[model samples]
Target chain A: MSYKAKFRVWRGEGGEGKLEDFTVEVNEGEVVLDIIHRLQATQAPDLAVRWNCKAGKCGSCSMEINGKPKLGCMTRMSTFSEDETITVTPMRTFPVIKDLVTDVSFNYQKAREIPSFTPPANVQPGEYRMQQIDVERSQEFRKCIECFMCNNVCHVIRDHEENKPEFAGPRFLMRIAELDMHPYDVADRKDAAQEEHGLGYCNITKCCTEVCPEHIKITDNALIPMKERVVDRKYDPLVWLGNKIFKRSSSKS
Target chain B: MTQTTADSPARRQRAQIKERTLRTDQWWRYPLVTFIIFTAFLVYSTWAIFDTSYFASPYIAPYASPCLATSCPEGARLFGLAPFGDWYTLPPGLLILALPAGFRFTCYYYRKAYYRGFWLSPPACAVNEPHGKYTGESRFPLILQNIHRYFFYAAIVIGLILAWDAVLALVEKPVGLGTLILVVNAVFINLYTLSCHSCRHITAGRLNHFSKHPVRYRAWGFVSKLNAKHQQLALISMFTVVGADLYVRLVAKGIVNFPFA
Candidate 1:
């Protein structure tokens, strides 16, 4: 006899939700995503779960499977025991719009707070003279497919719901860090990062680092360094003195 | 054709040979080479730390002293050896090296690649085997190295302090020492940031299996090599900065003589 696996999928829209169970025949080469699609076709034709490309690259099928933020398509059903029942739910960080879809517009808003790049004054269009090494640093940030898995897993907004309004979360901070590290970006956004974006709230527990699908060093490379820069302007005695001296010199001139 | 070969030892031996040959390559394909390079860096750092020192007092060279015309009390105090001078020199120097090393290890790229054993022993083909129950035991200390996030905050704070000290050295007109420390801090920051596992992971042109562009694959191949060995240099550069900082501090504290100072 072939093994059969049971899935408890979240069913309903908006505030209405219930776990509906469906038993499906398990195959050797099947992943969790294939089972979900199979259940949708055979049992629940009206199911409205979101997915794209059916590959890990699309970052669309992000949901909590077995209470963990992961791409449904990438998770293999074989990782579980035959007797175990798999529970799937929408990501908790955002408001659920349907059975397995959540609103992620908050991330887009936070992204806008960061100042866009401004090129240097003496620039000609043909080609900018940048060393290969200089451009190499920010290139890592461009890989983000906006999965928001890092945002979902973040404890600041995930566990403490109050932090949502103030906290910019890990994904956008990575964007800010990416822009800050850009060699061509002349504008300094560190002050805005502190005053407006609430970068200081991130205590560097690195929970976001653990769940990142792209494996971005959110706490280490981006957030921590940006915090350090803010602290320098705010607290460093020498910078304070330099600012004061510069102010006086400029006023006299 | 092979009906009579079922019980033959020669056929069995051939089967065994094929199985053994088919076994996946070891994670560290060139362990000896990696070991030698790491060992050389370790030895050099140890030597650099113990060899340098200077007196606690500060004095300005005649050429570019800021106190020449005005009553630069701040400049005078900095010019002559003081507690701030000692405080300024050693701790920040060691920090310069230690922070970058710590950050690199905890980098995001390293975490993912190391978890899957990608860097040391990437499969010859990009295809993954069918998922099964994960049977491996967790490797603890290596896994726990993700604490680099905490270290990054510490490194950044320390780097800023070191940069301030560099600024002080410049204002006091000690051009040589100022340049040395500044250059050391900059290099440490560069190496630390560059060798970042997270940085490497994100910069991957496109994944080999997913990329549609032919040029992206070639670029990814180049970047992947740098990503593979990034963790090693990340450690080396971090320790190098720390050793350099310690040497400067020992000299500033009068515990050793700075041949350059």
Candidate 2:
């Protein structure tokens, strides 16, 4: 059941590029990644594309398919109409290296900005106990594969590149939120998420959640809860009065 | 894996390099204008708060109304201040302001508005921000913004207070244009307060199932409808708050007396 499928892949380097069309053979159960591989094999040998595992786990095949941010390996070919021209473009937010690959250094930089998990003094590594409820909460955020699809679809920094410095995008913000939620982690992440990570920039459009190949609730579970935590500390009058009565009880001064 | 030769007519060469990687257009203009407008509003509000002449019928000035201290002029104290006694002789506006300010400051929409407008942390899309490193609101002062839900609750109470003020505006048995203005001001304030992101969340955040909590679901529905125009409400409330304060001030000062009583 091999069929010749059409693909319009943006081919270029250093930012300037255009969609170049090609027809490649699609096998019975092939995905976009298979057709991209075929495009590499048959028509354009010099065509540059980044992929690993071809099983969607690697998250290496991230690109905009028909203007939608998605993992090429995960996006089934059957989703599109047979006669439809499949448009595969490089992720628009970052600088294009060549063909479908774009420089994803922005995400890496944001990752570095976040302070890593800090266990409490009493709890040694592998000795700490977490309630199942607490464990499940962190587990939900732990499912992220760093696909950058969430990053790509995030409108906060996606179209707004200057916002890159301020906004940490959805993924890293969620990472901070995850660390804050961890039971044993004693560090005050609420402030860090607010001041350093640009947590305020996310408007909860849920585009990140929509594009997540991992199906993680990036908005509802992570971002919104993180927002709520910020509210609890800052605006809660009881907390305000408590701060006045018992000053500096916590590590955060 | 490619058997095809490296040089092929079918293989299109990548496009020429772009001169500048990012947008070259004027992206900073919008945020800059927003910055200017908000700054002006802050200045005007600060000036209005200090002006002791803001009272007309002791009910005219919304900002100074329910003035709790003994120092407040005749008929100004809606209630006496027993708890915060002798704290200061500052206008009740100082005591009353934090509610609406907190609501606006921590507002989801205002967070975005000010984050871009004042911070210039990007200012707008594709435009480089002034600062090299952005730490974000997870810190001490900024983390306080998280209490927006609490502020939402406070704003609702404050909105009720302002609405009461509107009712009291006509209690002297005078039918004047001031009465209409005060009523409209209260309406806008309520619109803004009810349309808050926290209000929307509070209405539905606790519910596991909408079908289980029909009332909250309906409340959320109304809040959502208002939330859609949240931006308009934010601006409208701002104008009304300032307008109501200024109107009372002028009338009390005998500067622009619109006599109907």
Candidate 3:
């Protein structure tokens, strides 16, 4: 059965905008993005919204749904009652370039800071061998679709613009953790993760983990385990004595 | 641009430029206090490290524990090896000071304190920081902060040495106010060290099934409790370490003398 759905979407640009209300037709088995499209086609054709891959794969439709970070493409209309008013806003962590489209240059800068995968000199690209367990460990972190929801939800930069400089946020830190966990990749990322990537800023709030569409155990598997590795290399006395004698840095390949 | 079906939609219009919020409350108070306190400690420790004459028989200064050099007093010697001999010309206090210093510098709680206090990295939530760019701990010297856990092991050994010194504070005679203060100092150091983030992680982290490792789980619970009071312990511990040094310094300088003798 077709029903009228109420949506409050924020519109405008240059850091100036407002939540404009619209009463749109909601079709059966349709998502929030579909309703947004309907509003664009039927009512306000000039309404600006960013989306691709309506299946939620592209992560381009990321926005705040009812104050919660969510993909418009994944949120089904069935989740809400017919009388509900869904409020959608642009991602808050970055500068809004237009309605629903934010300039995610902060994420790009963090990505650039992370040193690329440094392979072992002993093996060529195809000759590299790794255990299945090692691959699985890194594979879990690979689920990130660059949605930036985790980044937007993170309090480090979400509320505090000043912390944006130091904190690499959850998304990129997970990337560093992934590479650090990769057995075939030879680089000492432990120090870099804390010193460069702002791993220390993370208070283990797990907000990023909660907002992750991929259900990645970002806090438990990646961040916490990385913290453990740092402890092993930095604070353990045996490691200190060994390093003093062996002259090895904390770079675990 | 989307066509407005009517002049304006039925929602709230944002007429003003939306920038980051500036917290209304005196949010600077927290970080300001933190800044003053940490700076005071740093200055005190620097002075305490240089003044090696702070030892009055049997009461070794907390900073100068395990005085393993030739310049040490007969009673101050914890072990007899100043590897470089005469080349190790500095006071014994400076020798072992780096361990505890490193431990505190990389400490998770202290990191927050200093990040907010010293660097003004946001200073507090909802307030803008001074720096335009943040490279985090990924770069050169800041990356060394990752070695905090290693410092924890060092702290354990240092704590043990301090405990021995506290016991030794009364070696000349047990019934003194000086001995009492030393005992209290030792307790504070132990609490702070045990409550460390690394200690908490070592106690319980990386365990998927807590039911199987019941003993580890139990240890983790205890550490977690301590971890909760880490910030408070960190402050108190800093005070006690400096206070212990101050007491010994005053005694050595002929200002503080107990009647226990």
Candidate 4:
């Protein structure tokens, strides 16, 4: 007997939505995403789900499968019990635009607020010199795919809507931190980070880090150092004095 | 060195070499190096608290009346509403700040690094005197270090308050140079704070599968760089705070001017 799988896919627009069930034939080597596409082609035309690169690389297939945020393309149908109902829904955190599509424009807006790279005055474009060791430190943060899975799972924004305006969320902050730690980038956004981006609101529960599919050390490498730097600037007496002396000396010279 | 005949000379030589190795390894067990590093941190932290005036200085140039209690501008205030009042009042505040940094320096991650990279072992355990082994309680105090999450939160809050103070100085007079320095200091603080290991772990926890995206790979690259010399920055970050604090204080005290006294 050929195997059949049941899929309850969310279908509708905006706030109005309902799950429509469709049973699709499955082969041994097929992934869940493939099955969804097959259903879209044969069972439900205009199914209205977003996907790019059947491979997981584009981060376009992010959705909740059976109550878990996952890349649809990566989840294998074989993992589920043959008779179990596979429920597919759009990510819950963001506002749904249409069907599985969500409005992730907020994340992009947060990205713009972060301080961009500013090389030191002495560093020319071509002649910029950074040790292999120094560049290696910032390399990990550059890997972020902007999937916002970390953002989605983050309780700061997910559970608390009030935090949305103030908080930059974990992924964006990690991006800012990545640029900040870059050996050649001289621009600093620490003040903006605190007031505008809401760096202080994160209680460091590590929920964002735990959900990062990239396995990036979001809490340890990005958030903690940013916090430490903030503390150092806020409280360290010597730095305060040095800034005073330097400011004085520079004015005279 | 004379070899005893109770065993072969080669065995005796091997024993002697092993003893020498043990003695060399035992040197760090004396608690002296740890004490020295701790003292150095204390001295640096002390210097950071009192001698510098970054947090307490006025925004204007040639700040006169260095000793006056009310000399501080609104920008120099610590934690928004609280003022240190005088230069002498900062040491206790600094002591409170330094405690966590010092404790975190001896965290499990650092402990593992020290054991493997530096080959340093803990001192003799209190309960295991007969075995002459270090079998101290590892669960409680180490687990207690988890409070770093809370400390991280506090650091962000305090850092913002300081940044706000810096902004107040910038807004009050709009000294271009002072503003630039203040901005730079603020940026460094945010960078250090955001790059914390705890934050990374928390963020990474949400990700279910990461094999598809190339950007995630790049993020790991950035994280690895910060993780490599985290210990060094852990120390430098503490010093940078002191440096920022001193800048604020000296300007507030009228011991120095914005441009120069």
Candidate 5:
């Protein structure tokens, strides 16, 4: 089956843009990315879009569809009514380079801020051994394809640009949580997660978890557990007393 | 992708979009609904606390359980003990309401709900909040949410008391529909309490390795499973408690006659 689909794609450069409407042809089993490609081929020769793998794995085709953060490659034309007008816009959190493509360097900046896995001084790479259960704790987060949709949808930075300097958003915060939960990575991430990465800004709205394409429980399994773990160092009086009485040095210190 | 615009001044700033969000979907509906529900719960709980008619023999209202005052009906008194004597004139619910109330208020899930629903702190994901400044929970007052573990302990004690009340309802002569309701409410209370994020953490959160602590690992797994549904349990338990309290209140007022009462 073939039909014409309406599209309202945002087009602009240098931070100025408007939604430009296009009537594009659609085919059976075609995703939004396909219709977008068709628009580029037939109608608008100068349309700008960033895409790598159309298989929904590259995490390169992320755009807002009908006001929801989604992958253009994953959203099928079948999900929308034939007459419905689909709107494609660049992610609102970052600077726009051109149509349907926003500068995602903010995510890379936050990613760089987090300290990578630091193992014990004695344990070699091959010497590291952990239970399957421990591996599963962080395995859920490994599914993240760097979609950056979580960062885009997170309100801390999405609505407030000033917060960009403080909050790490959900994606990198989950990265810190993953390393913190690792059985062998001994660096103490609890303090740095709050003080440096702005873990405290997350009000646990779970919007990141909602928009996650990988179905990972980012809030439940990673963020909340990390928040509670932070309490062991910062808030728990009993833990403070125990540390004082025993004279045990923290992992990082 | 990184080399597309190097050292461009415009690349340093976010896109100058004028609209709060281009979202065409009804994003406002969620927070508005959440506001209405929380407000209704607050209003009903306020009324439930002040009303003294909270007992109907074998079934004590959850809000007024443990009937600490001497003014309480003899049949409704917990094991016929009045700890406060006649010195305390206020409602018994006033004495203990703070505990469960504190638990819910400090709950991680409820924090999200009320923050979005009531405070309008970026009500939905992309919507702009009216507030100009956002310090979040890092400061005083909101930072007190760290005391959630203490509230979790209090909630466990309250859950135990509610369980005892449910048992009393079961054993004290004929069981009515109120008995079933109270029992279900007690179950829900415990479920919500055990499913707490704090509970999940205390079980095994700080452990460096789960292999060494087999028992804590098992407990952590159970709590983690329950914690996934914490939001649903939070809402269900709230409504069930209200329903249980209202049922007992109506029976105490002689408004509704249950079979075998």
Candidate 6:
């Protein structure tokens, strides 16, 4: 059934803003994004919001609905009662450019810092052989939609802006993990992950896993395994003894 | 309309909105509940450990299981073997508690629990933590969490011992309510132990090609499935272990009696 829904949307630009309340008409089977669109079309044409795909896949319509970081398109309007005043705000981790449109360049910057997949020189294209089981390990991480919800919700950068420089956040760390687990890639990601990419900053709160639109187990499947791998190289005494006795060849020059 | 120039302060940096988080939800409830449960477990476990009355006819307290002390009563001693002999005179709980305790302390799931629940390390998602600095698991004491795999081995041995206790209870006379409790607790403990993240890693981790190792691949597949339910198993097993121990202790004290024992 259609009803009048109350919305308290944050509207501002250049760091100055306030929550503007609007009573808008809503229909059945509509999402929060649909309501925002209605408000923009009817009440506030100047309202600035970032959205690309109305579907959940593109990860463009990410915002905080009632203080939880969620995809605007994925969150159903039916979840909230008609009398409830729904509040919409931008992702807290990144800087805001306008209402609900934050400068997400921090994620882009972190993405650039990670080393892409690198294979051995001798292994030519189309010659790669991998087990389906081995392929499946990294395959779960491949489902990431670059939603940055994981990054935005992660408290390491969400509250601490200073951490933005050192920590790569969950998204790129998962990327590093995916490449490290790749059967073909030979780059030594374990050391780089710990030392450079700030893998140690991640405490595996599983918040990233919680907020993921694709339902990827970011903390469990990717981040935790990578932590354990780093432990093998950096901490394990038995591994240290084995390396000392056998003198294993270093992957990096 | 205010036009923003290139030199504007807002253009230069992030919006200076000052609040811990905009989250209107009851985010504090989770950590608070976690804190209460963990603290209660700690207090209960300490009482159960030091009381030294953890034995009835067919049942033994979980915290005091595999009783290794020379002073352990004949019936409570595991496999009728006193490995420590008279050299160790303390309560059986003191000797046997280390392995399982260490395992849980170093557990990945428990780390998240205590860190958020006790340490308030960003108490909940998107909320500000009280600590000025966060070294995480990068440094000395916290870095020691890497040794969780070692504890996993200890936990396996403990699990086996607990299973043996359950078997002993089963074979003895009529199956009492205590026997059933011990068996269920043992099963839950084994499930929790098997579902460890370290177990998953040891099963499949570091292997570049799973095609070559079919057996390990199958084992990894089983473990990966179990690992998904690790957190739930951790909680259930925690409760079961304590409940099992408490039941046995009550029976020993003659405070509560069940049928068939």
* Top candidate, metric lDDT: 5
* Model 4 agreement with the true structure over A1-253: per-residue lDDT tens digits: 3489988887755535677788999888888888888988998877767789877778888876765567888888888888888887776667666667766777888888776788778877899755554555568887777778777766556544556778888898887777666656656566566567776655454556655667788877687666545533453454458758767321101
TM-score of each: 0.50, 0.60, 0.60, 0.50, 0.96, 0.95
Model 5, A83-103: lDDT tens per residue? 999988888888888888888
Tens-place lDDT per residue, model 3, A7-64, is 8887776457777899989989998889889988998786778898987779889887
What are the candidates' C-alpha RMSDs? 18.4, 9.6, 10.1, 25.1, 2.2, 2.2
What C-alpha lDDT does candidate 1 achieve relative to the native structure? 0.55
lDDT of 6 by residue, A180-250 (tens): 88888888888988988888888888889989999998999899988878877887887667667888643
Runs in model 3 deviating more than 4 A are: A1-14, A17-225, A230-253, B1-20, B79-84, B170-172
Give the worst 10-residue stretch by lDDT in candidate 1 chain B: B12-21
DockQ for candidate 3, please give it: 0.08
Please give the C-alpha DockQ score of model 4.
0.02
User: How do the residues B180-249 of candidate 1 rate in per-residue lDDT, one tens digit apiece?
Assistant: 6545654555545544443333243212121333455455455456545565656555455555445455
lDDT (Cα, tens digit) per residue for candidate 4, span B114-224: 332233232211101122222121124433443555566555665565466457667765764455555566665555655556544333311212233346545755654
When 3 and 4 are scored with lDDT, the better candidate is 3
Predicted model with the maximum DockQ: 5
Chain B, TM-score, each prediction?
0.43, 0.85, 0.89, 0.56, 0.95, 0.94
Better of 3 and 6 by DockQ: 6
Task: Evaluate chain B of model 4: give its TM-score.
Answer: 0.56
TM-score of chain A of each: 0.89, 0.94, 0.94, 0.89, 0.96, 0.96
Q: Taking the candidates in order, what DockQ does each have?
A: 0.02, 0.09, 0.08, 0.02, 0.58, 0.53
Shift in Å, residue A220, candidate 2:
10
Q: Specify the highest-TM-score model's number.
A: 5
